[model samples]
Target: MSRKLLIDIHTHLYLPRYAQLLRARSQIPRITTLNGEERLVILAGEAATGRPVGPSYWDRDAKLRFMDTHGIAISIVSPANPWLDFLPPAPALQTCEALNSDLEEYCATSPEVELGGRRRKRLYGMGYLPVVPGQEVGGVCAAVEALGKLPHIKGVILGTQGLGKGLDDPALLPMWESIAKAGLVVFLHPHYGMPPEVWGAQENGHVLPLALGFPFETTTAVARLILTGILDKLPALKLLLAHSGGALPVLSSRLASCIAHDPVAASRLAHDARYYLGRMWYDAVAYGPEELAFVVPTRGTDRLLCGTDHPFFPPLKGEEMWMSVTENLDAVENAPGWSEGEKEGVRGGNAVELFGL
Candidate 1:
């Protein structure tokens, strides 16, 4: 049997300029040396959470090699979390332009990798814009306009916090309008999880933050967007939710029940909470067949896209093949109640159609 065409829609890369900028800073999102190795510190309470930084996070050759080894035909790469979120508007705008340009160059020039005996691997760029706190709406729109003109840029990846107001603020109307007008898809990812206070004083590593907080952050942000009628207002906007809509699909019924019990919350949207679940696209990063099974019913298979967070979720067993990547593939391939054609769609067909890859 021939191998299926695979496209990874959720991978990330930090261009050299962005990495250098982080290396020179002293703040939380900065890079610091620990035991002669560069490590990325991205949160305020990151004293014990920083991961070792390496070439895979920013090198083009390293990314292509990984794609070849994994049989990924095309990878849509984007700037990872907390992306220019900490910078002031002027430098943030300039940094965004440089970062997008660098990403565009890599996607346009990356060598074709041999996959399944066919040299078919390629990379596509997802540009960044100056969406940060305290920036003037007009300045952010200017950045959006610049990104739209970049030929190789297919879309953008954004942190849950939209201009630090958490995506529900009316101040974001202009930026959303600009991206919608540009025909760019929004890859909504989570960077800032729930408050540290919610985690308590457990020294349990990243399980709490990664397993619980991250999904809740995305769930809350999207809920805010839905309740504020922003999703309804922007009908043409396309959003791809990271981490399988981040607990939103599973917890949707509970949210809808709560809204029903309260007139104020129920009055916020013209439609029910369940409507938004069907409105957005979801990535198959949930890690198990049963999880994908549940997600299929919530959003349908046509909306599913495959992703391997790469470089972020490395194999801990020192194996060349990442369990993070293979496990998700296994889940999608074996997910119950999905037809063969639907399985192929979840793997890469949806991404190809959604991003024009």
Candidate 2:
């Protein structure tokens, strides 16, 4: 059988308009110039501090080129991290509206440009929500409702922070309910990797944070959601966890053991831990075949989807295939006990079915 049609479900973009906004801001996570070098300072790190911001991040044409080069037939785009999370209420709401509308238009109306005599497939996007601005729950609900009306928008991409106090906050239930009602999948991506102090003084760059800290944050967020019975409460809500559920596949047994040992916590759990784990979906971003093999069976092939994390982990100097992308593809190819059909499901078919693409 032909290799499954590849879909990059986790690719990111900083739309030209959004890139302008980032450039205008003077912040640690925003773009900055030091010593005649324009750097995209997303996070403080020792490994080159962060590369300069460029067209690859914001230009729509660049995205299509990358997709074509990588043999990706479809991409589900979302705004990269630090998404409207730092803005205050009024501006945050406006920014979210503009960005969502811009993204919706880009994905829905943008014309396909031909590459190698074949036209590129149209892209799909996940809308953004202004959760940090303390927008009224009603307004937040309205935003989600609006996303459902857009043809190209299949879901909303979110960070671990819900409302203000992480995903476990009770105040987020109404928002969750609204999203569930709207049938918008929640693509839960991580931003605030552990607290900075946890990395130690000697650590100087994004390597540890991006590689290790991110997964930990995702794991913690999902754990909080599970512990609070959020999954059971919002049964219809579909969630896709980035970085393959952030180590949940391997650490789930330990989490269950911990909960089981605690009589009070275990008593409060509305359902078995595994039930919640089985309910959510994961992306195939693990770096090695063993890691993918370990995570896929635990989450089930149906729940796994492919992701490239584009515009983030670009190929290292002089490399042809990006280590980030190849590792994930290799993992899917080598996962044990899964048939080629099952592997195809994890690679792309699952996403196409789940996202209705």
Candidate 3:
């Protein structure tokens, strides 16, 4: 029998060089020196206790070890969130180039270093984009074109904010067109959670925002893209939404109803509300079997891919496996009406086929 090939489509890595740069900065979202100890802190809620930060974030060997233990055959790595978005124009552009080059090289070459008495299988990566400093549409198009040529890069990982405004902004069309023309899939991930005011007085560490805010932000961004006719304009553009499209599958019907009721939205949009929803792909990271069942039918099983948001949700106290990852795997295992072949696709085959791995 063939082994169950597992591909973690949504894993993250903070390259050691990049982490060093972040550690030197003394900012809210950056690393800081407190009581003579340097630590990294991002979310405000997690600032008090401070989450653990270390080599597991950067060292490639650690990633290999984790994958070996977990049975993950391949990982499509991207730089963790808040990438280069905070840097100035020149620096951001340079950083983006360097990271992309580093990722491409890393993916294309096999490391001489071996772990667990065996050299690891080839790893792959998606390049990062400098969408913040709001580059001119020409510059943005050029950058996308450059990334598309890199041998190991399958796509670019983008945040919700597109060129400063949300993804729906009209100014981003040229960049979208260039990306579509390049035939690159856009791996849409989330960074900005919700407006802080929405979280209320909760100081529950990063739990509330990381779990709920990330997905919500992704859902809103994609919906806006649909509403603004971006999807209609670029039918060839393929998008992979993180966290099972961040509640989009569950709320699609309501979105359609709202669009039907609101003449403005209906008139502006070129197609039915759910038209673009079916065009995109989703990661199987909804945290439960029921959530997977809910999303698969909505997005279609072929478009669903499995992911482990590793390093972010490591084993909590007394937990042998990550609740985040196990829940996702179990979801695919138990999702109702999935034939064994469909389950195999979601497990990893879909990504292999979609990304041309």
Clash pairs detected, candidate 1: none
What TM-score does each of the candidates earn? 0.94, 0.93, 0.92
Greater-lDDT candidate between 1 and 2: 1
What's the lDDT for all of these models?
A: 0.84, 0.81, 0.81
Q: In candidate 3, how many Å is residue 263 off? A: 2.5
Candidate with the greatest TM-score versus the true structure: 1
Ranking by TM-score: 1, 2, 3
lDDT by residue (56-119, candidate 3, tens digit) is: 6887888878787777788888888888778776777778888888888777774432323455
Ten contiguous residues minimizing lDDT sum, candidate 2: 112-121
Candidate 2 residue lDDT tens string, 14-113: 8877777877987756777767876786665522555866777888888888887878778899889878787787787788888899998889776664
Compared with the true structure, model 3 gives a TM-score of 0.92
Which ranges in model 3 have alpha carbons more than 4 Å from their true place? 1-3, 33-38, 111-121, 318-320
Error of 3 at 29 (Å): 2.4
* Model 1: per-residue Cα lDDT over 237-347, one tens digit each: 888999998888888889888888889988777777887778889999999998887677757999999999987888776888988799999999889878899888888
Model 2, CA-based lDDT: 0.81
lDDT value, candidate 3, whole model? 0.81
